[model samples]
Target: MTDRDAGTAEASARPGPGTDPDPLLRIEGLRKSYGDEEVLRGVDMALDRQDVEVIIGPSGSGKSTLLRCVNRLTEFRGGDVFLDGESVLAMDENDLRRRVGMVFQDINLFAHLTARENVTLGLRRVLGMDREAADDRAMAHLKRVGLAPQSESYPAELSGGQKQRVGIARALAMDPDLLLFDEPTSALDPELVGEVLGVMSDLADGGMTMLVVTHEMGFARRAATTLTFLDEGRIVERGPPDRLFEAPERDRTAEFLRRLTDLSEDRDR
Candidate 1:
């Protein structure tokens, strides 16, 4: 069975006309610009609870910027981001960050800290938990990512995949309502990619609400509830992954997927 099929059997029970009735995240007329160059232009989308939305696009298509805007890591010049009916822009930055966790492309672990320490830092500092409590929480999440054995190891001692898993563990430790992944596997070696994707697949099965920007089409095909294509700072098309991958409605969307497929084949050869 496909990974999505294995996990999404329960998704049909969610409350919409076809999906969830209430959106957990809603973006309306979102726009972002760097100096004079607009990166995102009038983008609109909504993700239901437990939905895994995968964004794919060519470089410079503002995919990363869109993810950042959702978490307020990058401020947008125009539009609104709402999570669970509350405006994200109006929420306190720390509180908002706590509610929305992010796993970056480059695993941003502290070099001086152990994996456990890295995971516990935010819990102890932001949530103001006692060390013992923080440690317990950290270890639990590390174990979830299959990294409990490496809890005492520093980032330098970990492989790229391990480090990324630690990053994921750190994010999960926050117990955020939503998670954002910005090309989570892009920095890893080809062999290391599967390990991270496997963890992500498990998260999807476990019903984590996630917004991900990735070129990992296999994972997208298997785990995403929706696939969105962005180009020139706008969403050109979006739908279920199977339909988008097999028969994209837009010429641009079809061409983009074809190029990605060709690139994947070339890399394999």
Candidate 2:
């Protein structure tokens, strides 16, 4: 990070809203692997209805995997996922999916459909909202994210920020109690990153309960109610972002902080 980014980070370190609500999502012994590479090893966390929790770590740290398991997009080898106190591991597939909304990092918008149609797909197909109502709801959410004018435009026609905004609107359209974001802006150019992060900042301002796996430390310090640092499939440290990042307890956590925040370093490498 740059000196200017550090100032921005400090400004964002002010405390956010109140404590998160009771476990909107809870995971226990959540393990997932591909071949012999274990992505999540007995990962555990409690996400509440009013949380703006940010998960950060280096690549392959299971940050994204944890979010996927919460949504059941990636099945776990063991453990249970509870949503609003209901165990997703035991629920029917459709029921589990409806309760959790996800916004992928890639901004997977439909090429053929306009932003309005892409945002309205799940509501129309799953919730049975008619076209007119779907359009109306879609428009409202689009306006909320500053993408109302782009609703009629195709994804290819919009800038990266606009597309990501539509992705946010599409997820919000479900009116989900818990929203999971997987590196939502990792693919964006640096200049475009702020727009997406700005929308997220506004969402945090609006008190949306969300769990985000992101590399945006400035954002975590500024917008998150709590910050979690993970490595090797486990949360190494978690707490208020300022304390955790500024004064981490674990050695690995300190190293992570120095690397991610680009803090001053010791003389030796």
Question: Any residue pairs clashing in model 1, and if so which?
Answer: 15-21, 16-19
Candidate 1 CA-lDDT value: 0.88
| C-alpha RMSD of candidate 1 | 6.2
Q: Top model by TM-score, which number?
A: 1
- The residue pairs in collision within model 2 are none
Question: What TM-score, over all chains together, does every model reach?
Answer: 0.92, 0.88
Candidate 1 lDDT, 141-244, residue by residue in tens: 99999999999999999999999999999999999999999999999998899999999999999999999999989899999998888887877777788888
Given candidate 1, what's the lDDT at residue 41?
78
Give me the displacement of residue 187 in model 1, in angstroms.
0.8
Model 1 segments beyond 4 Å from truth? 1-21
Model 2, CA-based lDDT: 0.80
